[model samples]
Target: MAEAAPERVYTEQEVEAYLGENLPHWKLERGWIRRTYRTHSWKSTLMVVNTVGHLAEAAWHHPDITASYAWVEVRLATHSAKGITDKDFALARKIEDVVCWQPGREGGPLEGTPAGDPRFAYIKYDKT
Candidate 1:
């Protein structure tokens, strides 16, 4: 029997739908699924850093990470391809599952907030 190929590349619209239905922790932003984690302190932050590093290594898909005393921001983007891919979303979902969130999860200072960026909106698609 022939092996089935993995669906790796997806249009931005498709990715938006996928993220909306399957991954609530992810948000479509700047062509990437952005998620942030808050830690108790610097030590906890380091722990998450190492854990994230290992996860990224295992997936063989790296993410842009910003860490500080109380938080770590994880951004997924396929820069080389200039858009999001299955690898990026897969890794984002995995990271979300691993990280524990509190009541106010998104309050932590975002490292690089893209203010008023138009690229994050759902891209128009042609169904016909």
Candidate 2:
């Protein structure tokens, strides 16, 4: 059975407390929980992006991702509610679970293989 989402409105205290206790790898910024990552190549970055897409679809909540040749910047915010909500917190947690940042780990193929260069491949991550 699917789990019901947390209530839509959370007080500022709730936001702060939840974030403080749960997301050590993410930082609250401009009403969003933000993180940045760089991959070995553009292909890896795209792979991470597609993985995030699947996650967003499954969660029915999305984040803001900026992917470039070698880096991906992710920002999660719940604009509809005007502040961070449980959904934002949930997504941030899920995202943190899937992005890796080992300094020299080659995520996989470079830009031209059949797998193609993703520039966004998602992997599990921790405080780097």
Candidate 3:
């Protein structure tokens, strides 16, 4: 069996540029790419954590996650590579897409959770 090639680690400048152009909400800090998601309640926070867990497991790339009563913070880096790499960015993009999805704005049949309603509120999506 052939071994996988080494992943290319991204420099800080490259990470910054990618974050600016592709993921405006994410930032590079302490040698890792990180993003924090705000939620309406603890339930929502757990949902975010579980969602991220599922995505990470499916992608076969994991991220360090921290959660509290109303927020979740995700930090991504390539542990084996000892730096941020393409895998981190790819997983981050997937996490952002799924975590921040709002079906109501997509003109699709699925109307998302009711806006301005605490009972149905989940993620506190960043305004674009």
Residue-level error in angstroms, candidate 3, position 90: 0.4
Q: Show model 1 residue runs off by greater than 4 Å.
A: 1-8, 101-128
Model 2 has an lDDT value of 0.71
Q: lDDT (0-100) at residue 120 of candidate 3?
A: 94
Alpha carbon lDDT of residue 5, candidate 1?
67
Write model 2 residue lDDT over 1-128, tens digit each, in one string: 99766558676667667777887666777677777766667677888888788888899988899988877788887776677777888887887666543444556543322323344343434434
lDDT of each: 0.70, 0.71, 0.96
In candidate 1, residue 104 scores what lDDT?
35
lDDT of 3 by residue, 1-110 (tens): 99999999999999999999999999999999999999999999999999999999999999999999999999999999999999999999999999999999999999
How should the candidates be ordered by lDDT, best one leading? Answer: 3, 2, 1
CA deviation > 4 Å runs, candidate 2? 1-17, 101-128
Per-prediction TM-score to the true structure, in the order listed = 0.65, 0.66, 0.98
How well is each residue in 88-110 modelled by candidate 1, as lDDT tens digits?
87788777656543323466664
What is residue 103's positional error in candidate 3, in angstroms?
0.3
